[model samples]
Target: DATLLHSNGLTVLPTGTDNDITLFGPINEIAPDAGIFESDIAIRYFDGPASASCPTTTAAATLLRIEGDLIVPLGGPATSCILQGDILTVEYTDPTDASGDPNTVTDSATFDLRNGVLQSDKSVYIIGADMILTVIEPDWDRDNDGAETYDLDAIEWDSDAATVTMGNAGGEGAAFDPEPSSLRETGDSTGIFQVVIEIPNTLAGDKLERGEEVVLEYTDWGPSGADYVGDEDEDINLTIFTSNFGATVELDQKVYSWTDKVYITIVAPDHNFDSNLIDEIGNSAEDPIKVATRGTDIDPYKLVETGTDTGIFTGEVILTGFTAHDADGDGVEGDASGTTAGVGPTDGFLAADDDDGITVSFEFSEDETVVGSALIRWNIGEVQWLEASYPATGTGVVRVVDPDMNLNPEAVDNFDTDVWSDSDAGGIDLTVTETNEATGIFEGTVFFTVTDESSGHRLRVAEGDTVTAEYEDNTLPDPYTTADELDITGTSIIGTIVPPLERAPASGIRVVDAFGNSLGEISVDQQVQITSDLANGQDRAQAFAYLVQVQDDNGVTVSLAWITGSLTAGQSFSPALSWIPDAPGTYTATAFVWESVDNPTALSPPVKTTVNVI
Candidate 1:
């Protein structure tokens, strides 16, 4: 009996104790022409009788087709040529589904072209194309096993150009045979062939001139060596254009005041090559220009681009105030003049009338390119540039009157007092009393005097001349002093101390017995007296004593009593202290004087009265 098995192709054999069977038929057949002949084959089993048919039948197998078409799937019109340095792609597909699974059939491709002229080696195309070709292959099981796997492949374009080589997806050793003009079985499993070709500028010479056309033909060779063809030829055209760009800046006002608004315009010629206001080339709508004073230590201000018109950008930077100058060598301007303080006025003011005009500058930059310009303007001027000016003499007069030389209003006028006389003119002598240092207050006498050409007699102050007084306080204990110009006006000025000063009075204490008698010896449990007195001649008459201490023979001092009371000038206070001693010994008593409970003064001399306690 004869048997047939079906698979990708056909297979025939004899079975059932028919080892000596002779079978004649097609073994493997492909579409349209080759396949298994289901009826024509004859089989002879065991050499007994010749059988024209098989007892058992199997499925029929189909043939594998490896033919495909090459196509230029992407890029441009079929008649248009690609740019000199542009990319082109070629793909291949199967027309005949001979392999049953047409999508899984592997394929390859190759290109043949003249680098202007063909080379001696047919396989070597001398095209100065200097092309970089990348082949994308499908993942497949080359061994035809049940398990599917993939192999990394390499590509060699222009074997002479050692630098022009392509590595497989795994970047391992060469995956394709460089000797043959064939692409690897690389591509998706769709029986497709895909390859990208890049022509570098360095290789595209005058031979490939602008407006010239070049043709590239690619062929798709199936994995089984069957060839197919379709849109394999592609045309590439060359075109070129050059670019020239620059920029300039202009201001609405050449000279600006501190209160003025700075309007800036930037003209960038050829910035928009297409002449469209839109930012196509990324060169439009650049950063804003920086505006700053030429020689002032001020933070630079940015004039942001508010809008653009025909490649011209407009921006504005509003100046709130101008930088100050230390004209009087005091480290700050207008401090003594009361012109600009705190946030300062937006109206700019020069230190003096003769000062030079301030120079304002504008700076523009993009990337590494930069440009700048400057203009001079006065603080007070017309729309145009001008210098500041002031009068030679002031119009207001200033004087210091009602001098409290002794800091006492009730005292009569004394000849030795440092008094200020009513003066009309020439400079006056001013004095500052010694400051309390602790309270930060002082009194001074200002003598208004005038000079004469002949007699040098006293004169009254004239109008238009001003005298200003300034003071400095040493707030930080003994070292640092911060000065400030006092804002004073009118004829009489009286300044008071922040914390009033106090004078410690002279005090003395006397120790006496409790019986109102002067006793030398006293027994334990007996009482004694401590008398505290304030002298009449002292600056202050009142005095206070807070503590009274008693010392025994062993030299151990104990606080016998605590007194918190005040005493008037020439007044005496006698307080009874009864600190009974447990042991027989001699004891002495003393008192402590304090200017006030909060302010402590020197302790008064101890007034001792010896007593024997037994």
Candidate 2:
């Protein structure tokens, strides 16, 4: 006689063998009306064969009747029965559900079963009409002023089938269908059903109050097809809280010139605690607002705290040392200035001040929405003091006039214009008439005119006042030669008496006449001389001359005269080449001296003397 045994107490089974079972029973019992005398036995049925030794079933149990002659074999049937287990307690407990507004709410439940024959591993199920979820917090109102309530109209059940359904009832929603594929025997009666319920975003409130809670109540079905005896319904409690806030930054002006006085004002409206503006740190004193700027044309400068008004803090900053060259010439400099104001101390805004000449105080409006007008002014006195002296020419007429209506002459006098005044003559107006042929002195006539200071009208000077004009040769060193004018028949000569042979052993030639000087008129053939003493050790030198016809702006030159020869070193030679021009025009006679006629290594630099051919 075979006996049904508990799956957990299966030590009675044969060990180390397949323990295959063969049942031979009567097809029909002799007792005619007894309904074939079938004896139903409880046994474990695995969807597939048990992996462990026979008799130790890893699957749930099913009832099988033994009345007819039947043969049971492995791998032939999808379901097979092993030994049964003693009945044990099965219950559901620990349901949890939570949500944050605008987000999904997740609900879960657990089934606890102990010491029982779990006939169907898929015993856990949720009742559609039994799940009740509600918002517990009275102040958790989102849609209306009344109490906020959440119904389980939209519910999602986590199972092998992953079934979802909708209901109109308060919390009575969809039922969870068992997933057979997910069923497996756990130690002959110990198994758990974990139910995951999801409330979609559609049901979640568009807005939710902070510090609110939700309660979920649901009944779970176990193997007996009844509500869990100990805990008829599982209750899940969940709380919600705030997660995020808002902040913003604004500015007064988008663009500013380097010299513009920018007004920066920072206002934090959100910082208003109670009726007054105060940060979380509790300091009511105008919050130290930091204003920073970033751009390409700006020099580094510090944003110093100038003062404050109302809840807005004020700071001054100057954009100095503009590197942009003003290529567009818009008068207003072109450079991008990006200013960002944040809540912080002034330490972060301080940088090494370059103190460039350009500076202006800037103020920003509260809320950074309006920028104050920028008044940029120059430090004229400081700038003029640092500037270099003005360059002056030997002879030029100076006319004084006031461009600005400000009658004060301080602006003009600051440029050292008074240095040109004649102390003895009261006021002097001199003109250059002619130059002396022998002494090379400039002769000029001088007169005087006085101006009525208030009306700026001219007046005659006192009769006996004599304004004598004198001259001094403050001629700075100039490269000679390259005469400005030359005569057709006149001789153009450039001479060098001494040579710096040690520094430049190789010789070079240059014109001795000052730039723009006339070489005299040339009516006929003219002689051009280049004279230079050769170095002491030089053996010989070669001289070359060319009369080049000056071209117009198109730069065309024609050789009028070409001469080349050799000369002895350490001796001065006058290479007086006769240049007879074919036409009267501006021409340059250039002379070159080389080491020798054949070798032609340069002994002197080329000298060009201009001649005017009439």
Candidate 3:
């Protein structure tokens, strides 16, 4: 029986030869039930010509006739329907019948025929009588597909390309490195790709404890084969700021004494967290991180006495296992005279049979000890006992022996050597007094006499050998408070001496103290600049008194030189400019105003401005 094809297929070649044509079989084969006609007839097919020659026999057609709905068989009923040998037609049956399933409608003679099919085996011009069918799978739903979420670290990222690779979960933990083609191509679109990175809580537990930064880098390569070379790679950095769960300790001062209580605090950056997240020991468990603060014990140490009269006393205290001292003891001295009766030692021991004559010991009160000295070690006993003392009397020398006598063993007078006298012992002479009054005013004078014991005459001490005067309440004033008062002020400039060709000239200022007191005066050599047009020093000086300047409190330059010669206070000076500028060069003219060099001498900064004599 001839098959009833649904659709047509064709092949058009340059020459309609037998081998140039293609063929397809009938697709809509049918079977029916009764006169009512039910058929497995969801069939569809393609139709085309069979050969290159014109149809000489029966003309092929996709027949659709039914015989009682059982077997609807049809084929080409005519022969020699003239057609061009080079033209073969193709047609299709049914809109969505790509698979040609045949289980639905019934077949009948009135059914539609899509097109003709062809066969080329015999070259008899069999046109459009054949059909073919194939099966296809159902479409898939992409949205409901299952996917696994992964952490940042769990994904393998190629640092070189700055890309993240997906990994398999609940398997061997294998990573899926996608090909470059898998990345979405960017062009007329915003080509931005992002990945979520989660930081681990265990890392940076001390600084953050709760917060961590999972550094993430992303890069993108431009499209390949673009019109022009592009700087396509892009880098993106992300940071997550978080809090720290730890303790902090601060101190009032760097050095702490043993008597002071060490202060500390224990707190977290955030107080609220699940209890399970807090770490207790080694910070492993708990919700929030736990913090503890402690301080070190300071050891109290005494000030060690280490020098003679008029010397320094050194001391130290250990704090937090660190050693610090009062800037190493220097310029130290001691006086054994004070507490001599209790702490001073004698010459030597005298045995039984010796009558070494009477030995008298001199002593002083603890309050009479010198300021920079101490009376220590009267006897080598438990305390090694020492006491701080100051100079009570005005500048006097205390001697260890008698005066006006040659009592030494080798003296011309040949006096006893055991006893202390002018010839045998040297004396310490003091001549200064200090007052600890709050006003810093000390009223005292030093008196001393140089005598020639043998001539019974008084020796003359040089005028400058000793000075006795009441220094009054002289002290350096506070720099900050006094600086802003009615005092001498000026400016400074970088000057150049043309005649000498010096890099910088001597430019200075003159100033005076609060009480019209002058600072040290400097009288340096001055020079003039020469203009190239003028011969030697012949050019007339054009004084620009209008071009002067001053500085404000914030050190900003301001035009305060309206009255050029007048600065702050009564100090003023004239800048003399008489010589001509022989060359085209720059020169600075400085005006200085200073006070007399008596008492507190004051100097002012130079107020100067450069003039280009061209």
Candidate 4:
């Protein structure tokens, strides 16, 4: 092996590029419509790459530069500062390319140093775009020879028609206007340049479809003259919705104009019912049908009572089931019974046909037993079907007829049904109601009971007294306190009637003056102070104090204001000087005097007065 001389070898080489240094000069500028000292531009590495030094000619390099201007300074310059409104033209180029390359392209950038720095707060960073340059120059002359002049250039300009769209892009009155630019320079790097551009409102853009524009106007309201700059240009983006125009659309069709009950339906692929009744429709189907009647008719699924001289009466409901399907190829049907099918007053038993769909109905009668506001609700449940057996060998029989085996398994279907009326039925809630029997005024007070919806506890509310109806309190039957009430002098109750009804007493607030006179008109800027034990933190007493300032047809506060405080029992308070009018004029002040204390229902009269202010 030693005799075999291996002479086939290779050598390595070092081939890499060196880093490069470059010159970076940023230019900052300001917008022409600068309300104050505003910078209108930003400096960025728009296109060129950073500088680089390479051992060879093939290396990456770039030059960093900036361009912009400065406009109106809100405040005057520091003391002794010579102000010059003449446009400042500052441009410089580094003699050597910072990329360390002998052959490199030159890039230009503008700079505005009116605010001492090359950048301004109003700088807008456009990721990729041409450089926009500007500089603020004072309208002053150093020579002071009675003649002052400065040269400048116009950077940008445009003109176009204002476009207005009625709706959005696809809506009405959509049009476009040509936006053009016009710019001119008075002198090269010396004099001031003026550019006149016009931006039309009707431009093409998704956001602009609603409303957008670049408005140009002369800040000085006086007639346009040759010496002044055109009104500042403004860019505003806006959006308006169809609903803002009073357009309305409904998502659901089941609407109640007056009072009709509505029920939802679900079905399987075919009109046939599921053997397991798994397709039966009801509460389990997850579609709770909303009542269509708008209070005029019997509440949906609720038993309502009809009034008659013979006494109170009750009514019942008759039910029928139907089937439907999904026309699309989604394999899902909207109308189908799930779990339970077929019906006969049995709970969970739906009248559904195995081949198609079955229907069943039940009639109820009105009777005195079903007195005022009472009803029985029912909700159908689910049904299940039996499955066929597997191999016959598992049953100890390999051939012949296996007693435990299912023959023609496909031919036989098993289903279960349990149907009946439940007071707490999950679906199809029903209510029965009748008119109050006891009429005519009562001699004294009537007692009643208010039971809680949750705990079933009873609380007594006097006649005319207000009480809150809440589900947490077992008052679910009366969703709103409006539905929960006790019969004052009637044998029949307005709400769900239970034993031991409670009574409620009426209460409210009122107002009066110190001399027992009704407060007429309280003057403007007048403070009506109410001092009494009632102001000593009584929970039942509620007092409001305010001053009404007189206003002219122009909506200016022209008169003194009126003030009011608490008014209860025989207690009294006095009035003091109120608010000072912003403008001098003759105006009337009105004070509304009232209390929501012991007398919770009564409202006090308003007091008004006229005052003259210089």
Encode model 1's per-residue lDDT on 1-614: one tens digit a residue: 55543222333444553332223433344455654323322111111222232221111101101112211112212222211222223233545566654343443333222111111111211122222232322222122223222221332223211223333442322332222233323333432223323232222122222222232222222122111112132222122211223557666655443323345566653333222233222222333333444333222332323333265554444333322432112355432121221111122222211111233232322343444443433221101001111111211122222221112222222111112223332333334332332111233434323343211222233222233332221111112222322222233212111112222232444445655666556666655565555332322245555566788777798546766665544444554454655666877666555655576664354455565766
Scored against the true structure, residue 325 in model 2 reaches a CA lDDT of: 24
> Model-by-model lDDT, in order?
0.33, 0.28, 0.22, 0.23
Q: 299-379 in candidate 3: lDDT tens per residue? A: 111121232221122322111111121100122211001111111111111111000111111111111111111110001
Superposing all C-alpha atoms, what RMSD in Å does each candidate have to the true structure?
25.7, 26.7, 33.2, 37.7
lDDT for 161 (candidate 2): 22
* Model 2 quality (TM-score): 0.19
Q: Which tens-of-lDDT digit does each residue in 119-187 have in candidate 2?
A: 211222111111122222211122232222233332222222222333434222323222221222222
Q: Count the backbone clashes (under 3 Å) in each candidate.
A: 22, 32, 66, 121
The number of the candidate with the highest lDDT is: 1
**TM-score result, candidate 4:** 0.19
Off by over 4 Å in 3: 1-143, 148-198, 201-214, 218-237, 242-246, 249-265, 270-278, 281-614
lDDT of 2 at 467: 21
Worst 10 residues of 4 by lDDT: 396-405
Model 4, residue 435: displacement in angstroms?
7.7
Q: Which stretches of model 1 miss by more than 4 angstroms?
A: 1-511, 539-543, 569-576, 603-609
On a 0 to 100 scale, what is the lDDT of residue 257 in model 3? 20
